[model samples]
Target chain A: MIITPIDSTAPPEPTPTPTRTPTPPASSASVRRSRLGRTLEPFGFIAPTALLMLVLMIVPIVLVIGYSFTDNVILNKNPEFVGIENFVTVLTDGVFATAIGNTLVFTVVSVIAHLLIGLAFAMLLNSPLVSNASRAVFRVIYILPWLFTAAVIAVLWRMLLSPNGVVNYLLSSDLEWLSSPALALGAVTFINIWAGYPFFMVSLLAGLQGIPADLYEAATVDGANGVQRFFNVTLPQLRPIIISMTLLDLIWTSQQFALIWLTTGGGPINVTEMLSTFTYKLAFSRYEFALASTSAVLILLFSMVLAFFYVRHQRARD
Target chain B: MSKEAHGRRRTLRVLGASAAAVALFATAGCSASSDSGSGDGGDVTLEFAQWWEPELPDGAFRELMDEFEAENPGIKVELLSGPYASTKEQLFAGAAAGTMSDVVGLDGAWVSDFANQGAIADLTALMAESDYDDSELASQIQVDGATYMIPVVNFVYPMFTNDDLLAQAGVAAPPADRSEFAAAANAVAGLGDNTSGWILPLSLEAPNGIQNDVMSWVWATGGSMLDGGQPDVTNDEVTSAVEYIKGLWDEGAIAPGAFTMKEQDKVEEFTNGRVGMMIDSLAHINLIRETNPDLKFSISALPAEDGFDGERGIPYASWGIGVAESSEHPAEAWKLVDFLMSEETNAKLSSIANAFPGNTESVPDFVAEDELFATAFEIYQNGYPANEFTGLPVAEQLMRLFDEQFQVLLDGGQSVDEMLQKTQEAWLAEF
Candidate 1:
């Protein structure tokens, strides 16, 4: 749990005063009552949200984790406790291995693309050369892809990358972008970067805006060039936002299902098979609910490890 | 009465009237139930969920439903139709929630899984009572010793050729053997740059496209998708068949987007005069005829490999209606099935569907008169069901594994031998 700025705004830390002595409760019962009241006070405010999280998030996760240990296929009337059979099967399966590799590659490539492209756009938008009206127009244009549903965007891209589609028509090249096994994953990764960069751009732009103008002015006075200022001032200032956005982008990209499913259905082969799509196919298409649940738990573990590593890396950099 | 008292009295009168009206409506519902029981008045609506196109300019199915309602007097049909993919999805959801329709239109490939899951009722008793056991379609819908579906329409997947394209390419006849098919395809490819000699559905967009569409060739070469209820893709016959397809691909006879085109896309391409020939179900014949009336086309069985048995692969797959296991009104549901599978109704509907009727006695005059349909009917009666070997509960997964490996081969990333070995290993692990 990386502490955000909101967490820093909590109640002031207690200070010890040598000159003034504070009186304590006279009775143990009164002290106990005070402690109990204090302990439960925040819970009163959090109870509704806690209950909601328990029901909507925690409950389903628990059920999935439980089901992963059983032979809980949808067609099976009674799911018997099979211990770790499903997990063992999932671990031994080659498709699961392929899915893991695909997911990692997809996440890393997509996050990097989003960061690089987003940073570039943010810089361009923040530049003195761009007019305010132009900045506003470009912002709208850049974020437009995010506004459309994933299904619609996927379909639009599918048509565009189709064998005889607009891409081929315009380029006069007979490239099978979405259908070729070698090219399909790259095509989807490109689409994802296009659709996702806007989020990064928006967040990075905000972070960029929040940096004090004096810092850049000071860097300039110290004989720092534009590149030097960006590296020393801009990047450091935007570290927290970059870290959080990258973490979110990694999770979202790994869990992406609809766009890949709708466009290539995880393949000309399983070339574009992500863990999310594969898990969905296991449960819905194959009715292997237990295996799917196991895969899902594995994904949760992957996300946790990724977040942990990112937080640690950020701490090390600091 | 005083003015305030009079207003209160008026309100009470209105409430009294409303309560009486509600009571009368409740009574009427009871009476309707009673009337259905007595078979004297009122309608017994049976919900029928299917994936067929809802309306086709005075389609035979719609007409038959109207006729059945009029003839039966007390029975009415409520249709729940949607696209096939979503309908199958909803069926699974409905099964889990115990809210499945009284009768469901099921693909033949799904029968085994659904029956094993106990999602559908065993229709053995009903069929015996109705003497439907005599129908050939009955056996196709049976698993082990139990029948679970009333087959309505059976499709035979055969090769269809655009006669004009074949003629333009100076090909005189439909190919009857693999070598000839390849030659003809090359010839057609030579006709124009825009034209493809053959269109192969290599896209695993849907498992059915790969499992049934492309695998039909493997079957034609006397290869089976499964061996003894286990996933087996590395057998010599199947491997050789795939190699032959790869040979076709190598020769540039296959379409440009062979790996992306769905079955429907292939049909669309063929109808648009882009492909000389395509392998698809007989059900698409009517669609092609209606969509491209000027495109002279002919249908034939898939070409068999040399030195193999003369019998080519003609898929005898079907779509049928089944009573839900949880249906309360099994008798009423059976009535609808019986009506739909009756000789006359089945003939009319199956004709429109461009399929062989489940009712063997109901081969329409048109089917018998047309040479192509007659050939398809003969094949439908004699040929093995496309899903006979691999229609197990794990069919989809098995097909997916094959699709993955086959795709590598298609992309020229792996040899046929290596692809087969990898696919076999995956299959063994899964099984």
Candidate 2:
């Protein structure tokens, strides 16, 4: 015999109400006031955050933009407005052009390397053959590089890559890794890649775990190989996370200054000079705050463009 | 409650919280201002910012400050100590904000820039107003004929040689001229096992490498990179010096990675017994000894050019003192400066720091106690202290510019003439 299931979690149907005395209608002024309050309530909740953003973010950005159009700025008492002359000078600089090229290479190579390395590690950890205990140990080992601060990483790599260091000892080669004009940029980029991949690995691992097992089972039932499963199922499932991580990594790697400053210092004749270092030298080393501000604004614009794409991608995925 | 009443209450709560936050921030700012102002009970507080305290023996500088406090009851001193780079950054920020410390430790390279920007006080005028005696001071860093900094202690860069390496190379003594120096360097380099003859730190990050290592060679022979106080980088003396160094580079006599090596790395290499010789500050002698006590080394004058007979020019750096133009306690700051420059105090400071006293009349006891100090003292007495980068506008930038070109020259990217000409033009633009 079929038994009808009871819906206990659902609310009971409303009972018939008895007749009651009618209340007087409210006045027009009170109705108008209530409507106005309902409209303004959300704004009240957001007022503090909006005020903080105005003071901390918008104010400094506006000040920096104003300074970019002036001459000599902080070093001079009464600086004169020079319109876009500072921008003109920074754009015309050969060192700045070199910095742009170097930054592009460093960022693109670092992002690509981070993605490949992270994905490979995440796949290994996610394999069904791997035991939980072994996965835990391997996960910790893979994430070790990201735990170190930039300064520590810089010093560690410097010691390892020195001409007489352990790396040279193992290779039996005396290469000037950080100092060679041709090798300096690549060396720094490699270091950044080492330090950065763990971030991607952790994020992608979560994304990989979130994929339903039924999809993989279905692919296997359809006669797909391991590589085919990855390409057709795993990659497509993780595309959103991968895109987000790539854009974020690109932004971070492009702004890297401390590691390069502590390592090569954009040296061997500016072969590793990034835009961050170039701007830093203009302001602090050379005391040309106006030009530094101009360079900074240009960087901001570039970053804003990247951010626009990032936001658009995130919206579309949502 | 009615909806309008609830909304009004919520709005009032937010306004009240924001007011509290503003009040908190205002109070914090007021407290910070008060903390940075003069002390209680009419006592004047002078902030003394410097990089020397860390470099000196631990707590030795604090003791000196205590002595000053004991002598001057009405004025109190606060020490704001840090590394040189951070100190420079902080002081520059302070200068721009017009909140500089009353007393400041300066480098000779910073004097011209600080003076030109009106950040530092004219010590010549301050001295005259205070009736302070200036005769005993060894030298003063001046800008446009106005003294801005007084050297409190001097550390000269002298050639430090590993006696063991030299003996192994069959050199009887430290080279006395450029040719002998070159021969000794090559002989040592031939010893192999990753050994090199010399370590030249030409890193543009701290381009003082050019001042202390490269240009010191030119100065060793009474040569000058300046003509009538203007840059003469293309002059014959500089040309000869650059060519000599380039010859060494071609011979592979200099250490590898010299292009990116820093001054500290040079010191480390020498201390680790990895190099035969280096032109380094006498201030590092104690550090080298501390790091490697078994290492045998000797100090001597940097070798002069061949066939030259004149007093050598020793490249010297100093722990300089100055007062901020924005200081409220300028008089008290002058007292601190004068106290530091006094013969007794300068002697005590120099002895503790393993440096020569800036007061020529004051003799540090290290001269008689430590043989290395004695040798350096002899070199100091026989040679004239000279550094062309001192008192030059944007001196550090000039060094970086020259260093970039020098690296190119060493890499065979350009001729020595082209490097010097390019450097001269860059320097002229800065000047």
Best by TM-score: 2
Error of 1 at B286 (Å): 6.0
Question: How well is each residue in B157-193 modelled by candidate 1, as lDDT tens digits?
Answer: 8889889999999899998788889999999999865
True contacts kept of 1: 0.45
lDDT tens digits by residue: candidate 2, B10-112:
7776675676567557545644754564788999999999999998888999999999999999989999999998999999998998888999999998888
Deviating ranges (above 4 Å) for candidate 1: A1-52, A169-173, A209-224, A306-318, B1-45, B53-78, B96-99, B129-133, B136-139, B191-194, B218-240, B285-296, B306-313, B351-356, B363-391, B411-431
Count residue pairs with overlapping backbones in model 1. 0
- The ten-residue window of minimal lDDT in model 1 chain B covers B31-40
> What is candidate 1's CA lDDT for residue B371?
84
Q: Model 1 residue B20 lDDT? A: 51
